[model samples]
Structures are given as structure tokens and as C-alpha cells.
Target chain A: MTAPAYNKPLLDVRGLTIEIETRRGPAVIVDGINLTVGKGETVGVVGESGCGKSLTMLSLVRLLPNKIKVRGGTAVFDGRDLLQMSKSELRQVRGGKIGFVFQDPMTSLNPVMRIGDQLCEPLIYHRDMKKADARKRAIELLKLVGIPGPEQRIDAYPHELSGGMRQRVMIAIGLACDPELLIADEPTTALDVTIQAQIVDLVKELRRKLGMSVVWITHDLALIAGLVDRVAVLYAGTVVEDAPVGELFKRPTHPYTRGLLASIPKLSDERASRLSSIGGTPPEPGRRPKGCPFAPRCGLAEPICHEHVPALLSFAEEPRHRVACFVAQRQMMEAA
Target chain B: MAPANLTAFVDEDPPVSLWRDAWHRLFRNKLAVAGLVIVIFLALVAMFGPWLTPYDFLTQNLEVRNQAPSLAHLFGTDDLGRDVLSRVIYGTRTAFVVAIVVTTVAVAIGVALGAIAGYYGGLLDRTIMWFTDMTMSVPNLLLVVVINASLKTPVTAWMEAQYQATLNPFYRQTVWVDFLLVFGSMALISWPPYARLVRAQVLSIRGRPYVTAARALGLTNRLIIMRYIVPNAVGPLIVSVSAGLGTAMVLESAFSFLGVGVNPPTPSWGNMISDGLRVWQHYPHLLAAPAAVLGLATVAFSFLGDGLNDALNPRGSK
Candidate 1:
């Protein structure tokens, strides 16, 4: 696909594969996946639980947990390959160029340290800021995240703050260094619905104000409907569809993407009717179908869909929209 | 919606840190407070015992032998006519020294080994854990006794040789040899439990989300261990240490009673109790004084440890 001349991709990950060591042997948890975030773009990575969305983002920073390793991948951020960078160079990119917000705010923070101290840590390490200067900046960050009484709240421990406030603290920390890219992995799954919206709005405002790209990974498609510039729908470790946010909403081509979009409870639905849902769970890692990973669960799967995997191809009508589905590609070809 | 007034909900009282909160909880428990008070009192007595004793513990007064509770001697006199109160007071000093020194050495060794094993895991973890397990498998008393028996002669001989060669007054003091042997043997056996405790603590804290978050922030391994992992792992260690001090005191006393630790005239409680046990039929105060004091110190420490465990882990208490 052709890229806009002015918009250079900030972070481009190609053929990223992650594996988990199991009793049997190493099993592929994240297959060859490709994703990109352009400058100042917000990309929402939507998938079901255990579909490897989080692992893909974590693998970019080499932060996968023990026994779950990045088997192969090349994540290029700002012209340099993150997967091939030296230890020291990778460290510079970690909190300095790319910040990460984990899923659970409650446990992501150091319990013994004060919020102020935790915030000052990245500044002192990455920026070489003096302790006093770091403290001042920490107070400013607290204010930026909409936390009240920045001075007093900074001294409060993680337990003292409410869940919403703690999440705000997490966001403030993620934004502490003014990173070029922020990877937030389900930053609001643990919060109340109201708090979730508040967190989304906070990130949106900060991204617009600071002009930093964001990769938000979440299982909820509806949660990121208005928050992202594009959406990459993952099914069983691979991105089945990637499209502009509005185009994806208008026409989700991949069967799995269609199922996910259909599952979201619409306000216009019948009051007492049950919510629509996909029929089957995503295949297990080692036990994935030989052909398309989603073929077993895809109702529109044909004979060829079970024999060979489909490569991601751009739609003839919209070059920006890409889908990897044999049935969808055949139908589009016939219509054309 | 317009931003809610977030400051209105702020508590009137300033925020108390987790440690301060735990301290407050500890103070509220009457039993723990009593234990703390008793421990402080005993520590003070141990520190000032020399000045507090009216009579020299070594001084022999044949005329006043076997004297029962009197103004001249509060706890009464022993078979040798030495003041029992003075000896027991002096014993307190020995108990404190042995307990403190042995525990400090053990904790240092244990923390270093355990932290390294838990953090680095794989071959190093297996090797360290194997060593810890082997050390723990041996009988505690047998190990201490074997070490004292085998090492004491060589250490004492070396001190004597140093004295002869250099005429250094420091080497002439054979009491140091006894203490050196006792401390080494006791510390050797004392460390395995702490090593295991710290290893388990580190294993759990290593997997915590905060530690992973620290790594994600590009913090060095040393920084993550010192700032994130160790601080979180120290709660259980504190409780273990409190309980350990009491156990060390008892271990020292038991060894002294068996004539293997802090040999005669060093004024350990175990030696005094041994002396008291022999003549208790005629003079029961001799045995009762040191035994009662030892019992009190042990009970006090146990209570304080329990209180600390509950205070540090509030969730566990419920």
C-alpha cells in the first residue's frame, strides 16, 4: 500500500512471532503478525482474550514474561530495528522513546514506593534529571493527568489512591518522558465503565496535545471505537483485518472481524434479545488449524480456506484497507 | 462532564505511609505492646547490667553462701557464694551479644545467597538451593557440636601461637577463641532457614507485576532488585528476624548448659542454670532466677514476632 508522503510510520513491526515454553515444547502464541503506527496515529489492537495482542506489543519492547519469548520479529521504530538494537540502545528506547502502560494499574505500581518517587524514577534514569527537578516534573505530570492536589497526592502510596486515581497515576507515568510512542495494554479493563471513559478521554487529550503516537491493545472493540485512527483485528495470533477506523466500522470484511463487531451490544438492539457472539473459541496455540488460524471458527470458510493460509492483501476499492480471508477475497473478486 | 472536584474527598489528616500504618496497628494490639515493652526493658538491662550489679559476679563470699532472697542480694546467692543476681545480670549481656552477632552474620549470608539464587534462577538457582537443602538436612545440634569439637582445638592453638610469637595481649585472651568457635558454629547452622525464607520471598516478589514494570521502564537489574524486589520481600524477613533473635538466645543458653558454649566465668544463663540445677534441692532460687528470666525473654520475642507478622500482613490476619 502507498503511504502518505508527509506521514512516516513511527513504529513498524513485521513478521513478529512470539512463543511460550510449555510441557510439550515451545508453542507459537503470536504468529507472523504485521502492524504499523504512523506518526501521531492511534492504532487500536483488538482481539479476544489470549489472542496475543498484548504479547505482540510487549515483544516490540522485549518485555515478554519469563518462558514466553520473542522467537523472531523485527520491530523498527524511527528507522532503527528495535529487535536488533544493543542492550544499552534498547534501554534508551524503552522509557525514553517508547513508554508502556500495563493492564493492571493496581499491581503495576511499586507498593512500597510513593507515587512521586515512582514517577521520578524514569526521569532520573533516562533524562539524567536532578532529584529536585524530577520532583517538580512529577508534580506537573500529576496535574497533566487531571489528578487534584498534586503535591499531597504525590506522597500517597498506591493503596491510598482509589482505582481510578491509581490508573491516572499509571497514565501520568506512561506519559512522564513525553515518549514518541505509548503502548497501553488494556489500561481500562479493570476500572469502572465511567472511569474507563475518563481514562480514554485522558489519553485522547494527551495524544492530541503532545502529538505522540499510541498503540492501545484491548479486547473491547467498542471501547476504542472513537479513540483510535485505525483498528487491527487479531484472530488467533494473526491480524486478519487492518483498516481505517471509519472504514472498518462501515465494512468489516474478515469473518472474525465481522463476528467481533457483531458481538458488541448495540443500543438499537431489541431490549430483551441476547447479544450476538462468535460460535467457537480461538484455537489453542500448538493445536491451531493447519490452514487459516480462524478457519475452524469462520462460518464462511470454503474448501480452499481449510487447505491454505491467505496472505493479507489490500482491497481493490480501498488501498488502505487490508484483509486476510479466502472467502472474502473470492467474493470481492467475483463482484469486481 | 465537567471535571469533578477531586480535592474535596481528600482526608483531613495527612496520608500515613504503609510502615507508619503498620506501626499504628502494632501499637493497638495490647499483647504486642506488652512484648515490645518487655523486650526494650530487657535490652536496657542487658546494656547496663555491669553498672546495675551491686556485687562482682566473680567475687566469692564464703560466709554468705546459699543465702536466700535478702537486701544484700536480691535474687539470692549461689553455692559458690557469688551473687546470683549479679551472675544472671551478666548472663543477660552474653545472651544479647551471642544472639545479635550470630543473627547478623546469618542474615547477611542468607540474604546475599538467597537474593542471588532467586533473581538469577537456572543453574545458579539450582546450585544454591541444593547447598541450602544440604545444610538444612543436617541435625542442628549435631552440626554445632561437631564444628565446635573439630575447630576449637586448632583455633585455640593458633591463638596461643600468636601470643607466643608476638606477645600480643589480644591473643592471650582464650575466651575470644571460645566465643569465635561458638559464634562460627551457631551462625553456620542458623543461616539455612533464613536462606530458604529469603529465597522463597524473592521467588514470589520476582514475579510481581511491579518488578516487571520496573524492568519495562529500563531500570537496571540492580535498581529493580534494590528498589522494587528487596523492599517488598523484607516484610516477612522482619517477622522472621524477630522470631530468630529469641531462638538464638535459647540456642546459646542450651549450648552453654551442655558445657559446649561460653565456658565457665563468661556468665551465660545456661552455665548459671546448670550450676543452679545441681543444688536446687536446698536452694531453689539458684535455678529459678536464670530459668525464669530466659523463659520471659523467649516468650516476649515470640509474642512480638507474632504481632509483627499480623501487623505486616493485615490480609493474612483476617
Candidate 2:
């Protein structure tokens, strides 16, 4: 693992917590989390469904319903705390500075509106440009995203375009304002492998061209491998481990991270038995273990691991590579 | 551009307009087309009925009162000897006007209230809905009847005053007062349901992902409603307007039949039915013709409305 000196973090989130008031009581969905995305760097957040990864990104935009509230946290992006911003103020930051490419391209786009009108809405609202200019920019964007006949495609509806084309259009819309940061939540998950690769490559190319920071939220470890600089592994609404991509994959300190890594099919392995699946269902919201949230299913869990929650301890006096497990930390230092 | 990709050129299809799609689907429904034709014909008759007929709708002759169907007066005559065919023709004008005005007003109020209530939840939604609920709680027909009844005494007094001044038979009648009762009362009663329908529809659509995308794009609430919310919610609105028109016509006709809509000396289909029913055995043709017009008009409007509802919503396609 190497430390590439960051210019400056475009987004720095610290002590972020999210909770929803249920009939039972206030259920914590996202535990205290800290992360940062350097200007122009891509940080991949990988986790299974219900891992609170989606909530983390959504909370940054303050898009979650009123039922879900940020219990405590500060999301400082470009000198402003996003949590403190009002609805109107947040709107300026949301699409203007921080672009979001949602998962379902079909649903994300208005089915009734033309591609041109949809693409130009952001320029009109945030940039306050003239319609003609917005339309011109939109055509350019569609072309940039590899859509052919940009002029004609601009007037097409969401259903008329293929899934890949729709996704490209979504990317164009997201990058319309040249946002400082792009939060892509499973942007390629719904697509086929070739199309997924195309989207990934397109994102990477766009990042290079625009030098924009991106938080690529996905469940695929393989997709995150070559794309992201750092990786954050989440389980049961908490980040189990956070480290540089190579280090996390090479020497995963968290058992859940290890299981997730091992779950990826390797080319060399030849086995008669079925491919490994993470045993047991993920712990539901309120029923989360009081100590280490992963202790119940973790085979490495000791008595102490069940008694108290382990702080995200460093692997070897190194602050950058951290894991939330006392047993895992001790094992790591001993091996070192 | 070297050999502009032929497949790519073909793929870039234009988005279909919602109005165009609605029109396309409407054409597919033959019954709706037939209904539209009837409604148009009825509208034309209403607009030009006065010019087409010689006998004034209000003119009455006690000497020739309650005549049966004859060669000269096609549909025969009412109790006052005012031609039933003439009155029914002019009544088309009243029905068309009342239906158009009341439906337009109702839909305007309903769509506004519904969109606001749906788009903005919590207290705003509840308050608007509570008002809708209060309106819906009253039996619509009974409420309109009471409202109409309250206006009658003043109207009767006004009619007496007009009769005293002009001494013309038609001026002494209750025609103008009845028109006011039908238009005003129905408009007041019809708006609540449409508001409720729009509110329910908006509530569901406002939370959809596209709406979220629109907000994320920093679209103003007004622009979002106008461009996104209204267009999506229009299928229900079209249905409401169509059915609402039919309902308004029936309400007006009922009031006229009750002698509270347009009074004696002046003739309407409902008033003719009221006057003819008394001498049913002798002059059955007088009641039959107006009744036929009312039934046919209602059925035509309903078919048109059903067709419109089917055609306007593309998602309605299986």
C-alpha cells in the first residue's frame, strides 16, 4: 500500500450517524462513520444489500425522507457543512456541485420527457443558461457519452433508447455541470457485463478528463478492484474496515471483508463443491449484536468480542489501514 | 462524417408527444369516436338551436297547449303548447353550456387543490384533504337541492317583479333563475371529488424516482408540477372531466324536471318531461322525444369519456 498525497478532500464526512424512528424505538441505520474523498479520486464503497452503504451516500445529499434523520454528523464539502444546509441551499449543492448517477436509469429519467429536455433541466435550474445554450451543451454531452446521432437522440424518450444508451444519457446528465464530486450508486449493477464495463470505463475516462472526485457505491468487489483508490467495506450499517484497495484485498483485517474477498471467484481454484456463500442472513436493524455487530456470525469471535464493541483499531500503529475488531488487530500485529 | 453509422441513425427515434399518443388511442376506440360525434352534434345544435327553430322556447299558447306529435311540429307540444322539439333543441344549448362551464370550473379547482395537497404532504396535505372530506361528507345531490331551494324564494319574487314590469309571458317565467341554480350548485358540489382524485394521484407520483431526479436537478416546484406532475396525472384528470360533464348535465336536467331549474312558459327537456307526464296517455310523444334526447346525450358523453380515459394513458396498454 502506498500513500499518494491528496491535493485536498472535496468531501470529508465525520462522525455521521443516521436513525429512523420506528414503532419499537429509534433504530440506528448508519453508525458513526468517517471517510474522505480527495479531489479527483474515486472511493469505492462495497457491501451487500441492507449494509447501510446506500444510506451513507443518500444522507450526504439529505435525500432520505423525514422519517430518517441524521442523528449526528458533519458532511463538509467545499467549506460548507451539507448537514446544516437548508432545502434550497442543499439543492444548489446536490446537482450543481455533487452529481448523482442513480442505479435504475429507466426510473431515474422521466419517461414522458424528451432526452434533450431532461438533460437541459439541470443547466436551466442550476446554471441559469438560455434554452438554446442548454440544448447545445446537451447535444455535446450526449456525443461525449458515446451516443451516436446526438442531435436526434436528444429528442428521444427513455423507453425508446436501449439500456446502455439510457445509462450513457444518465452519465451525461449527471456530469452536465462538471460537478466537483460524482456519487454513482450502483451505476453499472443493472447492466450486462459488456455494457457494465463500458459504463465503468466511461466513468474512469470522464474522471480523467474532468478530474472530478467520485464515490462509486456498489456491491461488486471485482468492479471496485481496479477502479477505486481506496475501499470501504460495510456490514450491518457499519464500516467493518477501511484501507487502500490493494492493502484491503491483500490483507483484509475484518472477517466480513475476508469473507467478501473470498466470495469472489478466482481463476485458479478448481473445486467440486459449490461456490462459497456468506453463511447466515445479515442481522436485522434492531437485533444487531450489542458488542461487535459481526460477532454472531464471525467464526473468529472470542468471548471478549461479544462483551464490548471494538473501536476501529489500526493494524500496526498506522492510522490509514483500520479494522473494527480487537481479535483481528491482535492477529494482524502478531503476523507482522 | 464518414458513412454516418446507418444503425445509429435509425436508432435515434424521437419521443412521442403525450397529446399525440392520447389522440392515437382515442381514434382506436370506435365507440368513443361515435360518442364524440354525438357530443359535437349536440353542441352545434345547442349553439345554433335558436336559429334552426322558429317558435321561441319561452312562447306558450293556452289554446294549443299539450298537442300530440304532428307533421308540422315534429315532436308535438308541451303543456303550454310550446313545441317540445323546439324546447328540447334550446335545452341542448343550456345543457351544453352548463356542462362546459361547470366541468371546466370543477376541474380547475380540483386539479389545483389535488396537486397542491399531493405535492406537499404533512399539514398542508391534511388541511386540504380535511376540507375535501367535509365537502364529501354531505350528500351532493341533497346539498345542491338545499342550496337551490334557498335561492328559489328570492328568484320567485324577482320573476314576479319582472312579470309586473314587462307583462311578457316569457319574462314572467322562472327560466333565468333555474339556469343560475343548475350552474352554480353543480359547480360548488363537483369540485371536491376531483380535488381528492388529483391529490391521491399526485401523492403517489410526487414520490416517484423521476420526481426525485427532477428535484435533484434543482427544478422549481412550479415548473416540476407543470411539466412533470400535471402531465403524468392528466389521465385521471381527463376521465374526471369527461365523467364530470355527464354528471353535471344529469344534475341540471333533474333540477329542471323538479320545476326548480327553468320554470313554466320556458321549455327544457326536463320541464317538458314534467309537463308531459301529467298527460302521459294522451300525449306520450311529448315525453318520449325529450327523454330520448337526454338518454342518448348521457350515453354518448359516457362513451366518449371512457374512450378518452383508455386513449390518454399509454401505460393502459397491456
Which candidate should be chosen as best, given lDDT against the real structure?
1
Candidate 1 overall Cα lDDT vs. reference? 0.90
In model 2, residue pairs whose N, Cα or C atoms come closer than 3 Å (at least 3 residues apart or on different chains), thus clashing, are B178-B261
Q: How many residue pairs clash in each candidate?
A: 0, 1
TM-score of 1: 0.96
Q: C-alpha displacement of B120 in model 2, angstroms?
A: 2.5
lDDT by residue for model 2 (B1-318), tens: 112452444543356766787898898889999999998899889899979876777787777777777887778777777777788898788788888988888888889999998888889989988998888788867877787778778777888888899897876656566667777777787899899888888888888878877776667789889888988888888887888888888877787788666665555667777876787898788778888998989999999998988887657745
Which 10 consecutive positions of candidate 2 chain B have the poorest summed lDDT? B1-10
| lDDT of the candidates, in the order given | 0.90, 0.83
The model with the greatest DockQ is: 1
DockQ value for model 2: 0.42
